[model samples]
Target chain A: MDAMYQALLAPFIDFAFMQRALAGSLLLSLASCPVGVFLMVRRMSLTGDAMAHGILPGAAAGFLLFGLQIVPMTIGGLIAGMVVALGSGAVARFTVQKEDASMAAFYLISLAVGVLIVSLRGSSVDLMHVLFGTVLALNDAALTLIGLISVVTLVALAIFWRALVAECMDPLFLRSVSKLGTPVHFIFLALVVLNLVGGFQALGTLLSVGLMMLPAAAARFWTVRVEPMCLLATAIGMSSCVSGLLLSYHFSLPSGPAIILSAGVVYLASILIGSRGVLSTRNRPSRHRTA
Target chain B: MAEACITFSDLTLGYNNHPAVHHLTGTVAKGSLTAIVGANGSGKSTLMKGIVGVLKPISGKVAVKSGNRIAYLPQQSELDRSFPARVVDLVSLGLWPRRGLLGRYRPEDCDAVSRALVAVGLAGFEKRPIDTLSGGQLQRALFARVLVQDADLILLDEPFNAIDMKTLSDLIALIKRWHQESRTILVVAHDFDLVREHFPQALLLARQPVAWGDARKTLAPENLLRARQFHEAWDETAPWCGPDDAHSHHHDGEHHHHHDHAPDAIHKGAA
Candidate 1:
């Protein structure tokens, strides 16, 4: 128990890595909260997942092509993520097919494409780092990059938030009321792509979206106001990151999974405790069924 | 001389290049209460959309008198009432156009929101999460948002849908008060009786407009036949049904919309 306390509490006193991860996570949570709020309202949480995993190919391409340069690889990954988002949005708008189906189709194709290219080239250790991430290798430069990306994302979100909400609530009405609907939608999609790319070094392709989604989902059970909900989501994300980091350190487990599992715990807990908690469903008012 | 609040000159409303409403002309007076009515696929919603600028007409001009802010309420089917927003939060969105980024609302804005809530008969629901409200209350909450906008040009699509009759009566009373306050209102209604009793004027539209003017004259039997025919949508050349899939469609048969730019064309027609 004492040793456990030391690992959880002592790390703050000495290790800069732990401090950086905590700070990074806090900042990241702040950044992602607004994004998550909109994603839930827009019913695009899964889309975030697609974008998160969708960047793998570009990351792989950059590393293999440039021999592991951070800038080239990140740039490739960003572009790839955006392409997947924009393409999916366009396809859904134009076709009769559902957006979720389109997203899944693209996600699998992107992963397969990345894998195929990596295997065919026989030179992909750098690519794996991008795909699975290198949380332990989150040196000062990586932290700095993550911090900058998070700051940029939050600032943009703060400015465009009202328009974003209006658009999400009613695109047809919002388009009529404001002339910026198209711009707002594209800007939001771009932000999602950027955040997924920013978390690439720490969260990896498979896990980054979980952090984005689960904390926000957990926070939804607590409030209806956008501002409060967003703030709570950020706090949840930060706490998940800290606890996951501590648990990861103590157990020598993968930091990403620890964080995701922590977030999942919160989500399940909220679901159980929300008005229709598992045992309370019979007594609860039935949810209004939407067409 | 001042221009009419809205003016449509040889306007065509459509989604793609095709037009659902072709060669349409009209105008709306300031402080007028206008009703738009038609059958399913009659392009009633499309016309409202066109007026508000949600959809762009292919080859028509819809011009609005400048500097007139607008408050719009879309069809109920389009909104997700399950969101966590409260009645206050939903209404406050109306104030967004007034405040710039980083601009906080002054006390007066808050007062306006309160007044709007009261107007919609949602006086005590300032902090009520949207989900707690019944269908009628939800409509009222949305209407409160429009009041917060306090805009001179108010456009509502299917405002009375999914509500009990008492709530519909309450909404009509609220709309009447707004009209008395000198705001021009364009309401899309599915029920024929609501428009005849409350509005002095109406535009009966199908794939194209069958008639426009005093509600009694516009809803006359001969025009009603045209409205039904236009609504049944036998013709492809109408400007309201634009060739593109995303642009024009019918919802509850009372409005026409062009996908790219509905506002400009609608004002022209409204005028």
Candidate 2:
């Protein structure tokens, strides 16, 4: 354990790239967790996956055109994310198919498109690096992009929070009464796309969705209210980012997937030992209200 | 000093691009207890959606007096109770404009939610997850949602589709009290006897205002026949309501005697 701590903890504190990955991962997790819970509530988890896959070709294109530039790549990915959201949204509205099936079709085609593009450009290794990024490679630019994107997404969500929640819980009535129903819906999709793009550098496309979904899901074990769930998710996400970064540094493990796996562990633990989690004791005697 | 509070002047409503309810011209008097009754697919839900602004009218005006806060209770079937929302939180959504975005619950808002729950006979259910409730309990939870709206106008769609009879009566009594409080309430119902007993005014819609006025009287023999005819006309075989024109065209309907059909003639063609 001493040797393990030295290797993992020792380097994480001093290295600039490690610090960037840690900060970036925490922000991405904090951003995704609360939003992920709502998406799950709305039964749109698959839609999130679709957004990730859909953003891939854009990342590859941005790389081919702009090389390692964060801003251009982030923009390309954001646009692609919006297209996925809008495309899937159109399918959700116009077609008779359920959201999951439509999402599956969308992401499959898009992922294939990304893969084909990567192959065509003879940069499959570069594509893998883009998707499965290590903390060792993260720069100040990626961290800055994450910070700015987080602020924008957070502010936009904060502005429309109520309207968005109402739509997510039960849409039939809200859709009727709300004046900006369609706009609100698309704007939320846009926010999700933006968040994914923001986290693009630290988590890569694959781990971004996980960090968003799993931590929030883990927090669900502790609370029933939306606000509490959100707070809890942010806490869980931050813990994972910090711990996973230190662990990754000591062990020379990949930071992105390491952080995701840590979050996944927390999620499972919540599902098992959490206060209101599925496996937790129910029908407890009411003597201890505080407990 | 007095005018019909909610007026649908040549209004039509639909889904997608097809029309479900044709041009419907009617006025609901202020503080009136109105039941909208029709057989299944008689454009009853379509009419309810139109009234609530869930679905838009294709071409006509759905005018309501300005500055009215409307509390709406939708069909329970449409809500996802499995969500981790507590009954109190659900009720608290009624405090929307009052709570403002980022506004914490004031003492008054909390009191309102508590009172609403008590009114629905769900006083201690504040912390309960919505999924734990029975059908009757779910309906009561919805009643609590409307109560917190504190709205002068309340629109309920299929408020009692499937619940125990006792719970149904409990719901009706709560609604009656709201009506007595001078709030204009529009209930979407399938129970003929319930409407006859509770609502003095009704708009019996079979895609085209099948029968309007005097709930007890309009639901009578001749009116029921007209309702049946209009009901058949607005059946499922027809297309859905139109886009941006849900207010004016109903495809399944035909000419009717009680309602003025001048604007409806154009709607019938589109239908």
Candidate 3:
């Protein structure tokens, strides 16, 4: 039992950075995994992944302007993400390009611009830091930013819960009765961007959305309702974060990839063994009901 | 005539500046049950979208009477049934207009939802996820939502498409009940026989209005033929017709008489 405690709890208790990283990641997963569930339900998981890439340049610009400060990088990342998200949507609307195509174009450009910007003034180590993240290096400001953003996201989601669900199920019906649909959609997109920005500080731009989407996709096998799916995804995300942090501490693996890989494992397990999953369905008796 | 619930003043609606339904000018009277009949791609769906404010007008205006709430059901094909939501969750969205974004739902609202579900023969389906529902049950659930919406103007786009006979009859009965409640109801449908049997008024469309009046008169065999010809005559490169051309060709349809063809001509040709 003591050995298990040493393996599980010692690193977090012994090191301040580990505790900070765990706290920040926990808060982030709590907020973002639920948002990821919304993204999955709306068929926008790929869009979420694309927008995470889009956040890189703004964060890189912030790193350039203010070194590695959390506030500047967050603000810059948010601005860049919103620009790409809104700009891609506008481009899809006005031009002949579809949303997926425009998002792909914009995110690719953002990724290229971001890597170039980061590599201009800093070493390869700095580029790695920007791309893969350093959860172990989290400070007070980073922890606070993650915590605050998580709270704000949760509150906004609660307020817009009805509108969001209504929009997803039947957008035309929502629009005809009230003018809440478009604004609610924009607000939901902004929340997604905000969560990605908050998550990027710990998980990095590329892997942050993995935390958002993977657990959401995994949760699909466990439940068939939105609220439960959200709760289950958040729980799955938290577990991955904890296990990933421990794996990174003990096995000396990269934290971001470790976390995402843990989420992937959960997703795989869900597909195989979850109550409503593929394997379970395949194995169930094909008995007809006598009505 | 009853007061106008909706007015389209030379309304033209379409995508990318290409008119799908153009040169439409009419009033749907309050408490009127009107069937919008058209051939495939004849802008029946587009007209419904324009009325519900989904597709913006290209050149004209669609105005709903002030203080009249609108409830719209797009085609079933347009809905994502795979969405993770319970029947109760979908139906409760009807309270959005009454409750706004942040208002609390009173017990009476809950009761209203329950009553609506019962009315639609889905009394015990409150907790069932919408994804688990069969097509007919899903359609019934959607109807329950519309019932809870309690709107003054209800527009149903192809509501009967792919629906089984029993479900179709149940939904039709619901529409009839809504008509009895004096709601302005516009239905987009292809079954001319159903329209003639149930709806008092109809508008036959073919990108442009071919006829609009009594169901029997508007769906006259000659009008359906003209509608078909107009649909086929659509020129991709043609510019918007001038106002003089619009006035000359457009028909208010109430005065036009075809004394020769019998009304059952629809059962023979269109139905």
Model 1: fraction of native contacts: 0.60
Instruction: Determine the backbone clash count of candidate 3.
Output: 0
Index of the highest-DockQ prediction: 3
The runs of at least 3 residues in candidate 3 whose Cα sits more than 4 Å from the true structure, single-residue gaps closed, are A93-96, B16-18, B250-271
Q: Which stretches of candidate 1 lie over 4 Å from their true place?
A: A1-5, A93-98, A122-128, A274-291, B1-3, B15-18, B229-231, B234-271
Instruction: Enumerate clash totals for all models, in the order shown.
Output: 46, 21, 0
What's the distance in Å from true for residue B50, model 3?
A: 1.5
Per-prediction TM-score to the true structure, in the order listed:
0.86, 0.87, 0.91
**DockQ for candidate 1:** 0.45
lDDT of 3 by residue, B181-248 (tens): 99999999999999999998888888877777789988989888888876444567887666665555
Model 2 chain A: lowest-lDDT 10 consecutive positions: A172-181
Q: What is the DockQ of the complex in model 2?
A: 0.52
Docking class of 3: medium
- Candidates in order, interface RMSD in Å: 2.2, 2.3, 1.6
Clash pairs for candidate 3: none
